[model samples]
Structures are given as structure tokens and as C-alpha cells.
Target: MSAFTESALLKKLSELNTSQQSIQTLSLWLIHHRKHHTIIVQTWQRELQNVAEPKKLTFMYLANDVIQNSKKKGPEYGKEFSNVLPKVFAHIGESCKSDKLLGSLGRILNIWQERGVYDAKTIADYRGRLHKESSSSAAGAAGAHPVAATGNGNGNGTTKTPSDKHSKVTDKSEKREKRKHEERLSKSKRSRTSHHATAATPIVEPAAPAAEPENGHTPPYLPLGEPPEPEELIKALNSIENSASSDALVRERIAKLPPEISEISCISKLEDKEKAKLLANQVNEAVDLLNDYNARLAAEMEQRTKLAAMLRDFQAEQKELLAQAEQRLDEHKKKLAKMLGLQKEIHDHLSNLPDLTQLPDVTGGLAPLPSAGDLFNTLH
Candidate 1:
């Protein structure tokens, strides 16, 4: 088992086929990471919801494989799947009325019941939602994987159209001729005009995949946009010390300001003509300094708040990178282990074989059979 990401799981699900190898391999991975049963089931449900009707049965086949196989090892996957299966059944049962699908569903339900994959009540619920009466040989018919009805999943790895998934491959020229004929019928009653118009319209080729980023360029983050570094942020915060909040002398000046400058109740202190002018000058200067400082403080506050948001984004991007790296590391380790296992298997098999010297001496043994190449080595 390797690090399991939801995206990897979704990719695996999207590429899934009806082959026992495909289903069982994915099943084993899911069961190994059964602690993520919640996410696995949720991803499964989402995939089933998103696929075309024809391909939907493969998703169901996946669910059946995981549910039936995950039992005995741990019931977590089966239990988690149980929560969403009714909805899955309803979603699948409505769109898929294929007799093949119905028969498979019935057989699956029967297998589940016989194996006690789910409790009696749950079994009843599934039967009510998806079971269909079919021949008892469904298990035999389906062979190993329940989705054998799918023939070969998408046959040639192309996506299946909305029609039956098991349909035989149609000739491309036949389809093209039929489409052209339909176009002629739908046009102004002249066949030549329709033929000319259709001939003039070029077939649109499928678009090519986007080119990979050149010169080692890629997004700075797993998601778009990077945030300022801690060093840059610290510099920005230090620059904000020009603010009143960080200015001890400015705070002291504010504290020492006379009340007569701002208080109407203390206007009696400014009764003299010259003294009144002095008081007005004092008030004007204080107001100018305070107003300028207040504006700077507001701007600083806004900048600091934005910086906090950037910090949050920076942390999120870091976590995303770490998670991606961890997943890759686990996958690498798993591959390495598998390689070592294969190497050991090869060594063990070779050790079990008799070397050339260990053969029965061949002293009295019958002469070995000659090869066809040996006869040809001599003159004919």
C-alpha cells in the first residue's frame, strides 16, 4: 500500500475496467487504506454520479469488489459503503435497465446474502432497491468479476457512448455514411446541394493535449499563487513601527497634550486675547500630527491583516507540497519493496533448481534427445 490521495483514487476509478485484475488490484489498495474508508466511499459515490450511464456499471462493479472483499480483513469499508450504497443503487437502478445489469445486480445481492456481507436489514434494503429476478446461473455467467457483462469495459480504451456498453463495435465508414445520409435528408430537398455542403464542412479533429511547462517552470504552489516569505513579512512588519502604536514618544506626546485644546468645558482657560491665539495654534498643530498618525495606523492595520491572510495561504501551500511529496515517497518505497520481493523470488526459485553438476551423473542414463537445430547443423 502507498500514500492514498483522493485524486489518485479518482484517477484509478476513472480508468477502471471490468477485468478481475483491475477490480481486485484496486480493491486490495482500498482495503489496505481502509482507515480512509469514508473518503474512499465518498470518492466512489462521486465517480458513480459523474460517469456516463453505460460506464456506471463498472463503478458499481468496483463497489461490489471492495465491499465483498474488504470483509473478514476489516468491516470498515463495507460499513462505510453501506451508508451510500442505497443512493448508489437508486442512482444506478434508475438509469440502468439493461437485463445484463439487472441480472448481475441480483446475483451480487445473492452473493452478499450468502456471505453475510451485510446484515439482514441491510440486505433487505438493497434487495428492495436493486434486486431483479434472474436465472440462478448469474454467478456462473459473470464468471469472476461481477461486471463481465461490460465485455471489455471500453473495448479499445475509448470512452463508451450513452448506448449499451456491451454493443459490438460498429464500422467507422458505416457510421460516417449514415451520418452523411442523415445530413442529406435534413437539407433542402436536393441531394447534390446537401452533398456539396457536407463535403465542404471539414471534420473537426480532437484537440491536442496541452504542452508541458517549458524550462522547468511550474506553479509556485500546488494551487495557484504564492504568499510572501516570513523574511519579507518580518521586514514589512518592522517597517510598520513608524506607526503611533509602536511609537513610545508619540504616545507620550498624546498623553501630555493639554485638555483646553480639545475640551469646550475648559475654554475659560483661553480668555486672554494672546493666550486664545496660542491655544488655537496648539490645537491646530496637535490635530495635524494626530490625524496624520491616525491615517498611517489605519493603513498599517490593513496591511497587517493582509499579511496574516498571506501567511495562511503560505502555510496551506506548504502543507499541499508536503502531502504530495509524502505520497510520492510512499509510492516509491512500495515500488522498491516490490522490486526487492521479485528479486528474492527469483533467487529462491534459482536456489531450488538443480545445477548442472547435480544432474544424475548421466553415466548410465539414456542419451538425451537431439534438437531439431542439431539435425540442421549437419549437412542435410
Candidate 2:
């Protein structure tokens, strides 16, 4: 919400035909002016701390996108993002003011610049200014002390004290020491590059000058070799995952490259230690991928096991039902047999009783029929 958020700047910059002059100037100024960076980073951290989840993410995303775009497109690429750079800087400048916040900003900027997002001239100018400012501040602080600037309180002393002279000498000494350190770094980088050049298969382009690191020392990268960029590495891994097939060719390709080169695409400003760390992370990522694959396999196995158990239960239930049906069928068969036997017995009994009617009917039929008729005739 701070004025540095640069909503207007971001909006205007997002257009196709916005002025580049303002963007170039402002970006350069922001990068070059150490005090402004300090203020901006401090403000940024403070705001980030207080901001809610999605909103905080928005701020981070904006910053990251601006830097990433610049890295991909060039330093002047910020002109394309509307007011993003301005918004980010303004917001940070307005809100953050802690050393911790400043450190965070420094790390973010270092990564961006290292990624080739920053303008060379802008960074050079900024460093020049910083050197000058540091020198001047040290001198001013040493000279402005009441005891150091003035002789005694009596105000009559004319000669400079030893302590005052020592301060000036100390500043010069410090400057010389810094120069020596830079020389050593340059020599070390040269040696490393020469060593790598022997095994280098591809003709690599020279790396651009890197920004000073967090420790105030610039560490040079070893020359580029035949390896994919970090983005490419991740992309390859993702493709492998999405395809759901572990391609042996891809694994072979990754395995052939040294850990340093296989894990990252760009190592322009990375020190050997940083490169090692990145490699370690890549290893860890690979391990995680393997673990995920194993977990999926286990889950599939577990599902199959469940299905098999269900099938077995279903078969057992069917067998029990079949047995019960067979038992009922047997009981019906036995009852059918008994009913047939009873019918047979009844038939036999009726057959045997029928003969008696024929035999007894002869005598009974002859006597009974005539007697009634004769008596009636006589009475008439």
C-alpha cells in the first residue's frame, strides 16, 4: 500500500508504447542510490510482514515477475511491466526499515542481478556511487568528531593530532585491502576457468560481470560447460513426471553431466560453494521424485490387494448361497418321493375295494327290486 508500490508506473509500463526514458532513469537511480535501496528494502520487508496471505504473495509475485522478465528480456524489460518496478520500490521504501528486511531485499536483488536481469551500466554506476559514498562517509565521520576535528577545547591548537592522521591513513589502508581482495578473486577465477576449459566440450559465451555478493565480494563462476540450465533441468524433470514414465535416456543424460552443471542452466555469478549447494538440492529433488514413485506403486498394490480380498469374499458368499440352495432342493426331492408313495398306496386300496361291489350286487339287486313293486300292485 505504500507509495513505492508504483501502481501507476506499473500500469503505464504494461502498455505497448509507453516511454522507456522514465523507466531507464528511475531504474538506474534506484539501483545506483544505496540509501534509496536501503529505504526501499526495509519498507518492503515491513509491508510483507503485515500483509495478508494472497496480498503478500501478490507483492512477492510482482517483484519476482519484474526481475524474471528483466532477466529473460533484458534490463530494459522492466518497461513492459506497467508500474511494477516503481510499485515494488515505492512500497518497500515506504514501509520497510529494518536491517533484517534490508538483508532480505539484498538477497532478492542479488539473485535477480545474477540472473542477468539488471542493466550493466546501472549496476556499475550504483557500485561506483556506493564506493564514493562509503569513502566520504568514513572520512566525514572520522573528521567530524569534536575531539578529532578540533584540537583542545581552548581552540589555539594548529597541528593535527596523531589520531586524526591515523584515521586518514586507516581509510587508505582499507581501500588498498579491498583492492587486494578483488585481485585475489580475479586470479582465483582465472585459474578455475583454465582448469574447466580443458574438459569443456561446448564453446561457451563469456559471462557478464556479476554484482558484488552479499558478503561484499564478487565470486566468479567457472566457465559454462555442456549442461542444461536450471530451468531446463526442472522442466525435464517435470516432463518425466507428467509422462509417468521414467525415461532411461533422460536419466542417462543427467547422470553424465557433473553435479554442478546438471543441476543448473546458468552459473554466471555463483561461487563453487553455491554451485555445490544447488547440486545437492537437485539430488534431493531426484530423491523426492523416486520416493513419490514408490509411494504411488505401493498405493496401486494396496488397491489391488483390496480388490482381491473383495473378490474372495464375494466368491465365499456365492458358495454359501449355492450350498443353501442345494440343501433346499434335496428337501423338496424327499417330499416329492413321499407324496408319490402315498398316491400309489391310495390307488392300490381303491382297486382292492372295488371287487366287493360286483360280487354283493348280484343277490341284493334281484330281491329288493321285485318286492316293493309286487306289494304296490296287490294293494292297488
Candidate 3:
């Protein structure tokens, strides 16, 4: 691991901005030096505490990016950050008046829970600290509670002494007022529900925010293996010619090995020393050729083993992609079916309507109008 220095870390944190590029660049560096995760997290917490309030949210984004992207490599960063995140949340909550920033924190916390980044209890603890801090800040902003802060008749923060009879009357008045408030709320709720159920217009949903690239550039695809085509694999396989099995000429020569080299009796029967030496030399040459061919075969076998392993990995990733594709296909099919059903409903509703063109005209006297419920409530 490279040397870990607090100054160096502090420098990077100081240079950090709210941009995605800045956050991602820092996260990449942090993950690269993840061996020093404990120290990194400590330094991060210290910087967050000391940094100006406005930059605290930026620091939070950096932590989130690091913790999430580093999961596959190791869990050290996540664990260390989790230990400090409660304090980080509280600090941000105290200093941050922006509901948007606190909501982002809550969203990050939810993502952690969903992704199994932290256990339920740890997340709960973090959430509690966040809630407590947010609640205190909100209360402080809104000023103190009325009952405690308001004085009795005097400006001093003290309650006015009242007789028991007056106290009873005041309590009854408050209860009656509360009851009336509840009744109004109940009636409003019922009216809203009935209006919603009978509404004729289609409810339009809010437009979702446009998607942004991860690094403010091209979006990254998932790590699904993009294996080469079968033709490409075939060409590659054909290009590998390191072994005797790939050479027909070498195979033919091996098939025709002389008995002089193949048989022990043939070598022993040679009586002349020169002849024996010559035979030995010839055998040695043949042996060298075979050994060289065997070495080539060994190298070729190693290559083949590697190719096999690569193909296995590629296939596994392809299968995962295939499963995801199938799921998407199912969802799209369901959506298509729903759309078709909606079209049919529209046609049927139109057919049920009384055509104004075909209606009998009453020029001298007006005809009674059709009941509105009969037109709309037909779908019910």
C-alpha cells in the first residue's frame, strides 16, 4: 500500500467540490488506497466536522460514492464509514437548514438498508440520531413551544395562577375546540375520497426528472460480459498452431518412425561401433525433434486451458444478462397488455355514449336532459 498521510487526504478533501466528476475522482482515489480505509474514514470525519457548512453535503456525496462502489473489492470502507456516519448525519442535520439535503441523507440511508450495506439495527441507530438532530434543529428554528414560552399575564415566562373553576372551564373550551377540528378534518377527508372516486378526468402524474450521466458524461453500462461471436471464436481457434496435432506433416512423419529407433533389439544387433554411433546420432536427432514438438504441445495446452476458463466466465455473465433481459421482456409485455386493455375500454365507453347527432330534435319544446350518472357510472 502507498503511504497514507493526513495532510494529503485533507488537501484532497479541501479541493473536493460538489460536482460528480470531483466526487467520483476522489472516490476512485480512496478506493485505490482502500488499504488505509480506517485512517481515510477518520480523516474524512475530521474534515467534515471542520469544513464550512455548505460543503458538508459534498463530503457526504463523496462518502456515499466510495462506500457503494468499493463493496465488491472489500467491506472495510463501508464498515469504517458506518461507524462514523451517525456523527456525520447529526453534524449535517445541525448545520443544514436545507430540507433537500436532509432528505438526500435519508435517501442514502434507505439505499444502504435496501442494499444490505448495513444491518437493520445499525441503520436504525443512524436514523434515530439523524431524526433527533433534525427534530432539535427544527424546534430551534420554530422557536420554543407556546405553553412553556408564553407567560401568565406577565411578560415573564410563567403561567398565570387560575382558580379550579376557571381551569375546568378553560379545559372544556380546549377540548371542544379540538373536537370541532377533528370533525372538520374527518369531513374533509371523506369529501376528498368521494371526489377522487368519482373523478372523470384521467389523473396526470408528474413528469420524472431527466436522467443524468454518472460522471456528467456517457452513462456506464453494467459489467455483463460481451463475448465474441462464434465466427470470431472459430478464427481464434484456427489461428493457434503450436502443437503437432495442428500439423498434418508432423503427424505423418511420426506415423512412419523407423524400427531402428523404435526397437531395442534393432539397436543392439548393430555390431560395428561406427554404425552404432551413427544410429545413436540419428536417434538423438529424432528424439530432439520429438522433445521440441512436445514442448510446443505443452505451451499449446496451457493456452487452451486459459481459453476454456475465459469461455466459462463469459458464458456465466451472458446467462446473467439473459435472465435480466427475460425479466424486462416480461415487464414490457405486461405493459403492452395493459395499454391494449385501456384502448378497448376507451372504445367501449365511446360506443355507450348517446350520439348527439342521432338525437331527436325538440325545436318547439325542450326535452329532459339525460341523468349524468347514467353516462359516467356505466363503467362502474
lDDT winner? 3
lDDT of each: 0.61, 0.44, 0.64
TM-score of each: 0.35, 0.24, 0.39
TM-score ranking, high to low: 3, 1, 2
User: Residue 36 of candidate 1: its Cα lDDT?
Assistant: 88
In candidate 1, residue 198 scores what lDDT?
52
Runs of candidate 2 with Cα error greater than 4 angstroms are 1-61, 69-76, 79-97, 119-121, 127-136, 146-380
Instruction: List candidate 3 stretches off by more than 4 Å.
Output: 1-3, 137-380
Which of 1 and 3 is the better model by lDDT?
Answer: 3
lDDT score, candidate 3, position 323:
58
Candidate 1 Cα deviation (angstroms), residue 297: 94
Could you give candidate 1's per-residue lDDT for residues 1-380 as a string of tens digits?
45799989988888887654465557657876888899889988988888887567667667776676556567798778888989887766556656445544554564466457777788778755653222112333445344433555555443333332222212232244344434533442353334333543322211111112337753111111234567876887677666557888877898899888889876775568998888889999899889887777656655555555566546654564566578779989999999999999999999998888866676787888889999898757
Candidate 3 per-residue C-alpha lDDT over 73-116 given as tens digits, one digit per residue, 9 for 90 to 100: 78899889978988887777556555444544555565567567
Worst 10 residues of 3 by lDDT: 202-211
> Sorted by lDDT, highest first, which candidate order results?
3, 1, 2
